[model samples]
Structures are given as structure tokens and as C-alpha cells.
Target: MNKPLLLQAQRPFTAFAVRATPLATLCLVALLAGGCASPSYTITPEMQARAASENPAPPKDDDFPAPGSAKWQQGAFPSLEALRAMRTGMGKDQVRGLLGFPHFSEGLAGVREWNYIFHFRTGAGPDYITCQYMVRFNADVLTHGMYWKGAGCADLLKPPPAAMQPVATVRPTVVAPAKTTLGADGLFRFDGRSLDDLLPEGRRKLDALARDIRSDSGSAGAIRVTGHTDRLGSKPYNQALSLARANTVRDYLVQAGVPAQRMQVQGRGESEPKVHCAQARRAELIDCLAPNRRVDIEVLSGQ
Candidate 1:
């Protein structure tokens, strides 16, 4: 081989050795530090909230409020009167009127059951402990209800009276329902379902009806309003619309002097139609089905 060729090969070897020396030194340093290095971190509420936004966090037993917190009291809870009003075979609307909505509406075993959360003091130093109330339904009718197992549910039911009252020998009041049915067309425009949708004549009629109800009943008692819709929409949609309409009427009645405790509302949807529309698809079909869309109001006549 020529001497110049030998020099050319030697130059490449020198450069490689220089590059390898630095990389080997770095590897040695890293290996030495790896054994003694310790890392620590703090997680703040900000971090927790960020993590929550990225993933669903299931509720924990620890989520129960601390003792003496505002939530520990009976805020937004079913009252004693509501609990007493509940009865077997009552409709969903009636139950809702008694206890408001269930606390946990994500019913177990499908949509046939509902769970309500409540808290009560045990005086045993447990503070306001959490409990559950459960109700089961068959179709739209209530079947039964249950209290949280082993949670002293019965004790809360008949709590000790705050004070004693002199026993009075007086007859109890008796109340009966007086039903009234009104056509929806007179109250609403087409498919409207809000208080704002009340026609002028409808307002007058409702005012008169409210007066009649108060006069006929002699006292403001339990009021029940059931809303209906024509068979022109899906069941779920019609049900929701009918419920909205019923709520509107209920609110108006309450504003007009009916006691909220005495009011219950239901949405019958297209289930109880007064007349059947023929198969001919015409404008007349909707008008012919008008009788199906209506509201039924019932007030308790007291004695």
C-alpha cells in the first residue's frame, strides 16, 4: 500500500476516538447519579381538578359532608309531611309532589326504582349521617318504598315531638276530589307548553275556575292536574311536552292561590284520547284529534 493511503485511514480513527471519549464520560456520570437521586412532588387541588376533567371520578364514601357543615342539615330534603303523604299505589307525579324529585334518579335495576339521600342526627356523636330512601314503581304506579338498611330508618320516622300539646277532642277534616277537564286548545297555541302560552280567554277561564275551586272546596286542599297530548308525536316527546304543560298550569294555579303542598301534576300524554282521528291525512285530522289534547284539574273539597 501507498503511504498517502495509510495516512488517510489513520485520520478517520483519530476523530472516532475523540467522539467516544466524551460519550463514555457522560454514561459513567449518569450511572453514578442514578443510585442516589430521589424525586418528590406535591399534588394540589388544581391538579385534582385537572385530573377530574380528563377522567370521570366516582363518588367516594369520604364525599359525605363534615359535621356542622351547611349541607349536614336537612337542606333540600323530604319533610315529615311529605313522608306521611306517601302511600302505596300512588302515581309518580303524586310521589314527586310529596317529596320533590328523588335524590338519586339513576335508578338501580333499570328505571323501575329511585333512590333518595337524606341525613339525620343520631345524638351519638356521629353528626349528620347520610341515609337512603328507595321507592319502587310498576309502570307509572308506586309499588313500595324502603329505608336504608340498618340505618335506624324507623327511628327517624316517628321522631319525638318537640313539645307536648293538650289533647283536643275535635273531628278530623275530610276532603274529596272535585275533577274538572278543560280543552288544551283554549289554553295553548298549537304545541306551546308554558305559562306564556296561556291564551287570553284561557287566563280568564283559569281565573274563574280557580275561584270556583276555592269556593266549592271551602278550603285550599290537595290539587291534582294531569296533562294530555294528541297522538301526533312520539311517546317520549309527547310525555315530556305534556308534563311541561302540566307544570305550567300547576305553577299558574299556585300563583293564583292554590297551596303548593296541595298540588300534584301528571302527564298522561296520548294515552287517554277522547276521540280517534280517521286515517285520512288532512288538516281536519289534527282538528278532529283536538279533543285528545286537554288538561284535567282536580281539587280536594274539604269538610
Candidate 2:
């Protein structure tokens, strides 16, 4: 009220904004522009390899290989023998399971080498392997692919040998046991045509005898085991082999239910042969070689 406060404050009024420095403004614009740049980028070969080095990359088998471009036919698969079993021109699916995926392709047909490598668990470290298979194709169809794995890859190209003998279960029946007594030497000689093919009864009887003796200590006293074989092989070998078999029978008997302390074992191989031809055909052919190959187990009061 005193003269309308004639003092209109004498302070000056200035603009409310502070101007930015050119250098600072320039820095800010540059940073924003850099951040807004495009994310799209072209990957170089070297960059791709660097990334691959950090992680393993799967093998490539996409489009059909160019005819002249060195490429092994089909995919990696099983053993050469197994692959050879497949008919020519088989589809990829037919041989898929028989052999697994092809490892890697080698060069073109002429001396082309492919290694379908795999690992097997053995005593040693992983069984390192590389199998080179040769595939010969006529036109577009695959004629035949010589498959072999491991060293000597070229060998797989050849034909495998035919099995001559009746391998596995196809073997001929050389001897079928029957019950028949041999010479008067108190031995067994079963008709096996050969000494090697002795029946179980000859050995099983001794085992039983040993068990019976072992169970009863009284029988263990004066235990005498006599062994015999068919009329084959040298006197010494046959006798020794017979004795060993007899001892084995005795040991088995002892293990089954016989006392080791009260047991005796012996052998007399091939000293006797099957005099009774008829009995040799049956399962209990022991009588045929009873005297020849046998183990006489006698228990007496004295050991």
C-alpha cells in the first residue's frame, strides 16, 4: 500500500532453459545412432568356423551329390558281410538297420575310400576303427558295394568263403551213447567211433559215486577211483586223459556232495573199446565203453 510497493523487484528475469554444449550434444546423438543400427549381419566363413570350433557340427548329407563330385554311394552301415548280404539296388531303408548310417563319403568310384567308423567296448581303449568300402555302380543303380571294416579295407571287396563243415548245430551225429560193457578189465568202452566223443553217463556215474562216497564218511575210507577210456590214442595219453577225466568226475562228485578227505581218483583211457555195437546207439552207451573208459570207485575199510 505504501506507494503501491513502488519497488517492483529490480531483479532481471532470464529464460528458463540452459543451452547444451556442442561436444556433449554431438556425443549423445552419436550414441543413440549407434544403438539404433540394424541387427542383420552376414556371417563370414571364418566366423562360421569359429562358432563351429566352440560346438561340434553334425555331418552333411543333403542333396544328391554331383555325379563327378567324389562321393561314396549310399550311407555308412554295418559290417561288410552284413552289407554284402543285401541285394543290389536296395533302397536306403532296406539296409538302414542292417547297417547304421554311413559315416563319411570318400572319393569317386575309382579307388574311392569311405570310412564308417564305430567304437566297440574291449579291454583296451575304444576300439578305434575306420572301414573303407568300395561301391561300384552301373548307371544310377548301385551295382554292389564291397564292404569291409577296419584295416585291410580292400579285402572286403572279395567274396567271402563258404562254410565247409557243418558249423554250429548242423554237425553230424558221430556218437550217440548206449549202455554196453567192454573187456573184462572192469572198464567202459562206449561206441563213439572216436575217443573224443564220450557220453555224459560215463563221467556222471563217477560223479554220483563220488557224491555217495563223500556223503558217507564210512565210504570215504579206502576210496579207490579207477579211470578208463575208449580204444583210441596212445596208451600213455589215453590213460592220462582218462585219469584226468576220472579225476574231474571225482572232483565234480566231491563238489556236488562228496567228502574230499575220503575220495580217491584214477583214469585208464582207451584200454577198452565198445565190444557191443548194438548198445552204442542208445543214450546210456556206457556199457559199450564201460570197460574201456571208466572210473572204478571202490570204498573199503582202509584208505
Candidate 3:
């Protein structure tokens, strides 16, 4: 009789256990579904207003995920050029290509907004400003708008002023001497005043001078060629010889590529002596007066 009573009690307990199993299973399924559901990424009217605002307030907790959360990504240090390149109607991938992954929990797909914590240098120095940036997307997931939390942060995307930009170092141009002198004795045969009298050494020297003048043609201006003679001949005769020598030198230079229009010829005979020799011998006098008999070339710079 006691065994029968115990069996009756066991039947009730088994019935209760069977009923609880289905309820427990249903609860487990419901919990799993809730946990696996994706977060809503809808952009509300309020969010749009804030995004449109020229000066929006800083974001609150609702605007971003908690730090260290599963969706929170540490922000990046983006280049100013890249940030400036951002434009409306850019696809999500293109935006991501420039500024790395967004710094908030907003998922890549089915999301209409992305937030960032960007660091920008204030100047060339190490000092930087930390600003919150937001990129809003349309229903198509293409970027439609952008906003900044800090004042003047948007200005960072613009190019700096001309004065604020780095100035290139400009080295001053070195000007060559305006006047150059060459010995007539080195330029021609003794008592020679024509182009035919030019020695091989004289031709070579003139060639080099032509090359130099051509190299500086951009700055070279008027060129004056003057000839001087020693005090051995009559003033009138010496003057004519000097003038002939000046004309010959100018003509030779013109053939060597110097512009004839830029050259002017002059003769200063038996004047402007560099040395007054007291020597009695004719050779000594000629040698001492050699410095006075020469051609002077003057170049005025265009600058």
C-alpha cells in the first residue's frame, strides 16, 4: 500500500518535469533571437537637423558607442589633404578609402551615419586638436553630408593662406661685373687694328666670352666696346686706329653669336693711361704702356 502511494507521487513529479521542459526551451529561443538582432541605424529628423547646423553641439552618449565597446574603433590620424578630398555623393567605400574605418559602433552596411574622433595638427608643430567628425549617408549608403563638433574645425579642410603657407627660400642672383678689360696685345698682332689682325689666342678668348654672354643672355643688357691706344702716335692717328680696333672687336663678337644691336663702339686714344713710364728705352716704354692699350667691354644688367 505504501509503494503504491509513492508511485502516485512520482507520476505527478514526472508530469511537472515534462511541462517545464517546453517552457524552458521557448524562453531560451526568445533570448537568443533578442541577442542576435541588429541595432537600428535609422537617421532621425533630429539627427538631420544637427547635421545641418553650422555650429552643432558636441555629441552625447547616444551619438556614439561607449569606449572599449565591441563596435568602438580607435580613430585615425588622417591627412589634411585626404579630409579635404571628402565630397558629397561619395560611396561608402570611397569615403572609407580616404578616412579609414569610422571610430564608432555604426556598422558598415545598412548604416546611415558614421562618427570619428580625428586629431589634426594646429601647425607644423606637434600640437594637435582633437575633434569629433560625423559623416551622414543617404538611404543609398552614399555620403551626403559632414559635420564637425568644434568651432573652426571645418576651416582645417581649406588650404592655408598664402602668407601662412611655407615660404620657399629664394637665393639672390649674383651680378657679374659691369666692366671687363682685355689686353690689346693679347687680342691682335702688333699695330694691328682689323679683324684679320686677330691672333688664334684672341679668337679663342672671344669665343669663351661669347659663351659667357650667351649663358647670361637673360640678364645681359647693353654691351659697350671701347678701344684704347698707347701715346706713341699722333692724337688724330691714334684715335682713328683705336676706333678701327673697337669696330673690329665688335664685329668679331657679333659673328661669335653676340647681338650686334646691343654693342656700341668707342675710341679713347692716348688717354686714360694706366702707367706713366720714365723708361728711356723704346722697348721698356712699350712694355710699360701695354696696360693702357686694350679693349674694354661693359655689360649693363637688365635688372
Best by lDDT: 3
Query: Candidate 2: global Cα-lDDT?
Result: 0.41
What digit string (tens of lDDT, one per residue) describes model 3 on residues 54-99?
A: 2324455466544455243445678886786675445656777788
Best by TM-score: 1
Residue 252, model 2: lDDT of 51
Error of 1 at 252 (Å): 0.2
**TM-score of every prediction relative to native:** 0.44, 0.28, 0.42
lDDT of 1 by residue, 1-303 (tens): 799999998998999999999998876554332221123234332332222223223234354333244322343445764674454444555566676555432322335554456666658786775665655554323334433433566456543432433556973433333787888999988778777789998888787776565444356567889999999877766776676678788867755655556788877788889998795976889889988899999876544
| Segments of candidate 3 deviating more than 4 angstroms | 1-177
Ranking by TM-score: 1, 3, 2
Query: In terms of TM-score, how similar is model 1 to the real structure?
Result: 0.44
Query: How would you encode candidate 2's per-residue C-alpha lDDT over 78-133 as one tens digit per residue?
Result: 56456535433333333334654344433223322223443323347644444443
Query: Each candidate: what lDDT?
Result: 0.62, 0.41, 0.70
Model 3: how far residue 201 lies from native, Å: 0.8
Residues forming the 10-long window of minimal summed lDDT in candidate 2? 175-184
Q: For model 2, what is the error of residue 133's alpha carbon versus the real structure, in angstroms, after optimal superposition? A: 50
Model 1 is weakest, by summed lDDT over 10 consecutive residues, at: 31-40
